[model samples]
Target chain A: MDISSGVTETTIKSKKTVKKQKITKGNMTPYLFILPSFILIVGFLFYPIGTVFYYSLQHYDVAAPFYNGFAGLDNFVTIFTQDKMFLPSLLNSLKWVVTEVGLQLIFGMILALLLNQTFKLRGMARAVAFIPWAISGVLASSMWSLIFNEHMGVLNDLLMKLGLINEPQAFLASTTTAFTSVILAELWRGIPFFAITLLASLQSIPVDLYEAAKVDGASRWKTFIYVILPQLKNTIVLTTLLRVVWEFNNVDLLFNLTGGGPAHSTTTLTMYIADLAVHGSNFGYGSALTVITFAILLLFAIVYLKLSRYEKE
Target chain B: MIFNNKKADKLITLYLPLSMMLCFTIFPLYWTINTAFKPEGDIIKRPLQYLPANPTIDNFVNAWTNIGFATFFKNSLIVGVATVIVVLICSTLSGYALARYQFKGKRGFMLMLLCTQFIPRAMMIIPLFIIFKNLGLISNPLSLIITYSAVEIPFTTILMSGFISGVPKELEEAAMMDGCTKLQSLRYVVFPLLLPGIVATGVFTFIYTWNEFLIALMLTNQQNKFTLPVGLASMMGEFNVNYGALAAGSVIALIPAILLFAYAQKHLVNGMGGAVKG
Candidate 1:
């Protein structure tokens, strides 16, 4: 026993030494492994952001001499005070976030709750429901655009065919209709996310809780209110926050479907920035706008993190 | 009595979802397919036909030839394949290290990766475009491959790490004890277990790269180099919308995504449903 114990003690000591060496080596290894990705991020994400921050203060032009003199806070002032489109675009984006994310969450939750039930062909139904998510955003926007086209749109035709309307409507030409059209397209693409995420959350809930509630003579509504809603609260909050950030930053749907058109009615911050950068050749101003957008999104992200913390407790 | 109630409850539960699934899910698809088959003039004509009165393949033919869809298809394929390859390699190595090694800052590294996803694509577009332009990579398909890989790496790594963790380390250690090198141990022991994860990640990478528009739109400026989305977008100008050809193009773009999802449906579903343990 003494001899075996002595042998085991030596093994343990050697093992500890090996572990210490391994730990140190392992620390370096992860950094080495992640080094390439870190370099890419720095090269692509960090450096450009830093450049944008710098450029935001400079008076640069895309064409006719790229270099310009320092102009601190002036560009920001121009955007905030001078640019008439800026405030309205920002408001439109805010409206988009509330409507798109809000409606997506409500509808998605309802869809998820319905899908969560055991039924024949449940898998097929779920897959069918997720088909819209499989379609690319640009394609989805284009399809909707065709459907909303003033003269050639199928929507008007369908409504007329069904006796829902008397005349063909110019959905994309009017400012109010154009904004509504963009929001609807966004919602169409976004609703699936809520359904999928909420469905996943619903699946995670144990069936025993519902069974137990039933055993206690709880009605169906009472069981859903007491058992389901409380459990889904975290998922709902997180999804809502994610949807807000995503919707706030969305560019393609509105850009493609509306072209921020009908006198720039649908031009959100992203579209505005892209317009300045790509079309207007005001890279410096665009970069400034980009920075501002990031700042706003970061603020929201911090709020979301804080809310998540509160939810955790 | 209880069994009957449960049955009735199940049926009741299915009713709303089924109706919603038909409306929100199937209607748009039906509309698209319906529009795709309609005569060019009937597409915008009043009183939308539930079924195309005069379906024709002319739009498909026009979309195929006029839009230069063949080139777009080739570009999308090359970029998608290249992204999958690069992502699989880089993510596998990083994921393996993350899963197996007891490293300092592992948690922090993961958190950092997750944080990257929150940074909006719009924020990265300008910087990425500038960086690629500086490197003289504008209009290059290879540039897109690199950018897509970079954008996809973090998620792929996270997914792979989850998968690699599920693989037993004892097998690797056992292989090592047999005088096998670390690389050999990983190749023989750990890699087989990671195949499903790699497939899942590969499918996602392919789909994302295939569907990606903004980066592809900005990066590749040449007409011949334009991917499907850009190609389709070029059809729209100040006036004269090619509804038939555009609808046809939209259907064409749907093919690869649908086929990919179909091929990897099981793994994709599993991956989406939290198979990525992290």
Candidate 2:
């Protein structure tokens, strides 16, 4: 009996060792698979970001000395003091984030709630609603550009036809209207993201809660306020935060539509940086702007993290 | 009585969303398509025609030749397909690793990847431009391909990781026990099951790379090397707006996206749903 038990134990030990070996082999294989992506990220993503930081500290230019001596915080100081467009561009960015993110979230949540109902053609309706999101940002802006065109735009033509306004509105040319038009275009493209994300969240909510509320003779508003809103609280906050970051960074729509427009009314931080680098030929200042924007974004992220924490506890 | 109120409430709920969506979604498309058919002169004329008065295919024909769209289409296709393939391959392996393996620095690496998604691409544009220019890759379509793959990898990896993790580990174990090599197990066992995810990722990567404007706009200098968006953007000059040709070009550009979305609608919906859940 003792000899038989010993033999079984030895066989079990052998199998366990073999299993360990196989597991390590399997584990190592996934790393091999991920190697290409790691290489790509290092080359394209990390390297560029590192270079931007490096250039931010230097007084680098195209025609001038390639890697000039470090300027310390001089570029940043110049950006704050000397750069006339800095404060205005920053203000515009804020306006964009506030209006675009706020409207998108509110409208999106409302729409999501409305669509979350058990209705015929819900799927078709959802798909159709999501179409704007699929449109390229550049194309969407261009489409809106036509709508807001000063001479031949549809908006002015419609307004004139309806006797709302007799003259053509220079929607994209005017400072006030330029930002508004760009924001409207952004809202059109962005609302779909909010709608889809919120809709998914809405769907995850079980119908049982509503049924329970109904059994208790709760009103529609009461049920939503007490039940639905609570369930959606986390999603609403996260989506809003996400939208803020995205809107703050979005440049293409504004760039194409207005080119920061009639008198730099719609110029954002991104456009400002691009102008500095590509058009203005000031790579140092552009890198500085890039660094500043990154810092601001990091601050926003930190604030979001704090808010998320507050919500949790 | 209860049933009646519920039905009415349902109708009311559906009505608001339906109308809002129509206003937001279908109206722009309607506007674009309508304008495409309108005469160039009539586009700016007052008493706005909801329908085209004199519809002409001339705009399209002119745009097709003027913008060199056929070449742009081919360029976009090459870049898009290459991006999709690279992202899929890289993401799948990385995702599998993140999902299945308990490795050192695993969490840190994932967090790093996620952090990359937050870094605005605009911030890195100048540096990337310089790097590509230095590498002599700016003129090549492969430059955009590489850029797209880099930007897309993190999101795709996260997405694929979630999907792969949901796959039963027991099945993989069984395959291993059957004397399958790790790669063989991944190829024959895990990969087949991840087809839906792969398709979704592929479609997404394709759309993003295809539609990407800023990087493409900046990188490609020559007219012949232009992608659709860049080509379309170049049409807009300071003074004179070519309404007919521009609208025609814009419409042409929209076709590939629309067709791809139509083809992959189901997968996209599923993929987006999964992403949100994750």
Candidate 3:
């Protein structure tokens, strides 16, 4: 027994020594492993972002190369003063982010709670519910467009049958209805994201917590308030912030469904930027707007993080 | 009697609301599919055919051949597959590094990754256009493949590291003690367990690449190089739209993403949950 014990102890000590040796040797393998990711990120993301700042200061229109030169803050001034779309588009972006994230979170929380319950066909139901999460923004736009189409749209057919409208309304073509219609379509896609994330967090909560709440004579609503929401605080805050960033940058649905149309009623800042990049031929001005966007987002993120105190937990 | 009441409550609280949500979620897709199967003339018939009176595959045929969805689909496939491969390799290696090593700049590297998450994707459009244009890779598949791989790497690396951390290091160490090289141990022991994570990451990247529009639109202007989303967007912009072929094109785009999501959703949800929680 002593001999065997001694042998095992020596082996363990030798293993520790090996580990120490591995660390002390200053292994290059890890750096080598991380190099490709580092290179790609630097080359594409960081380098491009850096160029946005650089280009923001220059007059770099592809159409008018003769006018191209350093234009120190001229583009920003134009955006704030000369450009009409900047302020309204910024407001639209705020509206877009708030509505999309708020509605998504509320419905998503409810969906997550429902999915968390023990039920038959739970797996299949989850798969079905998250179908929208997997569908591309463009595809979702197409699907919604088909429903919003005036002549052959099922929505028009349904509305007429209900006697809600005497004539088929062109939802996307009208400014008043276009934003809301797009929001509803995006909401269908956005909710599943929150549901999936919230459900995952929900699953991680111990059953004993619920049982403990029950033992304390807490009702279901009370239990949820006391037990569930607190546990979900971190996930909620993080996902909301992430979702805000994502939705702010999202132009797919807006671009396809409305083309920021009906007189640019649906043009968020991102959509405006996309239009400029795609068609406007004003790279310098677009870059300046993009910089402002980045600044706003950074400001929002910092303020939001401070407010949520996300790191406190 | 109390038990019966509880069952009724479950029906109302759980099944009723869930079904409604499901309807809202699935209806658009169902509507699209319904339209896709209808003949071109039947699609616009009065009272709007809830179901195609005469189901046909002609729209699919037309979309695949006439509207050039075939080329778009092939281009999307190439970009998606290539990006996924690059992301998997880069993320796996970096993830293994982060999971195993106590290296300098580790915290900084992690912060860098997190910072990338907050970088507005819209900010990349103009500069990326210039950079790629300067590189003379405008409309090239290589531009897209490179851009997407970079965009996807940060998230996938974090996810991959989480997955690798879940794999206990002791197993690999034990294999090393049993006279196997680190590479061999990883190949034999860790790789099998990491397969699900790799699949989750791959699916995530593939879906993003498949569905991405703005960058794809900006990068690839050629008709033949358009990905599915770009192609779909262009088709939507036409003066006289073909709803049948459009819906048919949508279903074609929808299938791969949905199938992949359905297949790997279990890992995806759990992995995402872990990532978000962190």
Considering every candidate listed, which one attains the maximal lDDT? Answer: 3
- In model 1, the runs with Cα more than 4 Å from the true position are A1-28, A64-67, B1-12, B273-278
All models, RMSD in angstroms: 2.8, 3.1, 2.1
Q: List the residue pairs that clash in candidate 2.
A: none
Candidate 1 residue A18 Cα shift, in angstroms, is: 4.8
Clashes of each: 1, 0, 0
Which window of ten consecutive residues has the lowest lDDT sum in model 3 chain B? B263-272
Per-residue lDDT for A66-114 in model 1, tens only?
4677888888999888888888888878887889988888878788777
Docking class of 2: medium
lDDT of 1 by residue, B1-278 (tens): 76597677665566745685558666666777777888888876655677899889888888888778888888888888988998888888788778878766788877877777777777767767777888999999988888888788888888888888888878987998898998898888888877778887898899888888777888888999988777777675437778888888888998888877766665654565563223
Ranking by DockQ: 3, 2, 1
Stretches of candidate 3 off by over 4 Å are A1-16, A310-313, B1-3
Q: How many Å off is the CA of B68 in candidate 1?
A: 0.6
Q: Least accurate stretch of 10 residues (summed lDDT) in model 2 chain B?
A: B265-274
Residue A96 Cα positional deviation in candidate 3, in Å, after optimal superposition: 0.5
Residue B73 miss distance in model 3 (angstroms): 0.9
**Docking level of model 3:** high
